[model samples]
Target chain A: MRPEIVMLALAVGACTWAFRALPFRFDLTGLTPEGWLSRLLAATGPAAIAALCAVSVLPLVKGAAPPAPLGAGLGAVIGLWVWRRSVVLATLGGALAYGAVFAL
Target chain B: MGEARAQFAQGMVAGLPVVLGYFPIAFSFGVAASRAGFSAAETTAFSLIVYSGAAQFLAVALVAAGTPLLVAGFTLVAMGVRHLAYGPALMKHAGQGRTRRAWIWAFGLTDEVFGVALGDLARGRRFSEAFMAGLGLAAYLAWVSGSWAGALAGGGALAAYPAVEAGLGFMLPALFLALLLSILSRRQMPVILIAAGVTLGVTLAVSATAGILAGMLAGALTGALRRATA
Candidate 1:
């Protein structure tokens, strides 16, 4: 409970909250899906996910660890298989695959 | 009011998987923070407040390395700059829903929550402020509590099970990948591929923060290009 640490947490929280909340300030009430703004916003969702996934997975395969890639590969395969049905199931399948392989 | 309550309850239930996914990672963060000399309370504060998964871990390391608070804060915020897009992007798809409480719920737009919300909306689920409230709160509570448990357990709690640790580490990425698959469309394929490529290339060359911004812009611009030509 050091004073500096508390201050640091508050600062980080404030800055991040501002970043996340910035876009809500705009009025998007009647924006059409066909407009450039709407199109970009639509693209933003998948693109952002793409960027996040790239960054997340980059750490795993970086040093070429055996279990890491193997497990992740299995997870992707099984997850994709389950994906045809549901996201939750795909996630579970992927995680289980990775867990089993990484554990072994 | 009752309908809002029901929607909120539904959101919480839907958030259960995200709750499960986040706990292990937050636990790992707590252990890392402890190992980095953060007291249980400081470690918990990072989760309860900042709530950025990668940034929180980076904060622990940076602060431990004696990096100045200002520099560390700048770096963490820079790393999360991509989040600036999440709110507007989600609202655009949310279809003029009730937003009287967006200011309150928007504070909880963590990456997983954003992904889950985005996916649900893409799949034709209607947006509700109440639902987002329940979703965000559930995930937030899980994160804060998990960090607390990990902090109290200290660093050695999971050392004996390194494999499980690795598995837990992969949870967020797996969830993101699944969500990505869920919303992917033929038209958007190019956007996603280019975004991933630019992100990887820039991340390898410059930094992860630069990569994400570049990727998002590239993907969005590409989408705009297609829209214009169509």
Candidate 2:
């Protein structure tokens, strides 16, 4: 209901669209692995992702809450262990573990 | 036109795997958005508009945290900066390809779509805008529909199940961690580890916003400088 959500969505959308659509229209021959641009891309995805994961999870871990840690940690461990890197399984497993732990 | 249709069909078929892969993630995004207080319409609009899984997840989390709109917007865009290269990379791999309708189909160029298209090209498939369209559409529909389904299934519907809802609260972090693990490589390990450490430290010492920005900067700088030394 907040107007900010709409504006934020549209703003992000436009910027993302430009990211996806522009390279098709331009020549970026110099953007190679050896170049800083390549390393920047290479570094950015995982690093940002890792940072995001840590930032998001830190609060839960720091809270010392059993359900969250159990659900998130065990779920991720099991999900990764069982699904061989399936996001669905990990998320599902984590939620299940949390629920089961909370219930007990 | 028939050839285009055939190519499109081929693309649709190629996109089948992506459709399967996107559903769960999109569904998670939907559930997270719903739980984060987004209406089904707003959540669906996110997939319909922004379309990137990581960016959408970040957007939902940021919005939930009441992060300043500017910070959230910049973070979302920054997370997607890598995508700018996907297009160029795909084009490069697609030597002697079509570009006439790229403005349209390019919009569907999500990471998975790009991977499938690039793999096809690498395997000697000719580049075709029609194929890209087919691929993008199949994946896009799956994402939007998956989000809708998850949104409908989550939120108010789960009110009675506090335990389950608590578990689901961890879904965003769980998904992000899984994604992080999937992409973990020997080359990027240092960058990732340092980023995680820095993000935690700064966030604990200062603010989440400063922590994230600092983490990104530290991680990126580490990644860039390593190449110079090695």
- Candidate number of the best DockQ: 2
For B1-230, candidate 1 gives per-residue lDDT tens digits of: 99999989988987898898778667867887887899998999889889877678767766886867776666566556557668777877664546767778888888778878887888888889889999999889988998999899887776788776555556556655765676678878998999999999998999776776688778868777675544
Error of 1 at B65 (Å): 4.2
B1-230: candidate 2 lDDT, tens digit per residue: 99999999999999887787678667767888998899988998888888888788888878888898988887787777767767777777565446767878888887668867887898998788889999999999999999999888876766787776666666677667766776688888999999999999999999888888888888988888785545
Per-residue lDDT of A3-101 in model 1, one digit per residue for the tens?
A: 878888888888788767766766543576578876775677677678767876787778644656456654664556454545445655565567677
Q: How does residue B83 of candidate 1 score in lDDT?
A: 71
Tens-place lDDT per residue, model 2, A1-104, is: 56788888888888888878887777665566577866776788777888898987887777656744565456554556466545545555665566677767
CAPRI band for model 1: acceptable
- As for model 1, its CA RMSD to the true structure in angstroms is 5.1
Which candidate ranks first by TM-score, i.e. highest? 2
lDDT of 1: 0.75
Show the lowest summed lDDT stretch of 10 residues, model 2 chain B.
B91-100
TM-score of chain B of 1: 0.73
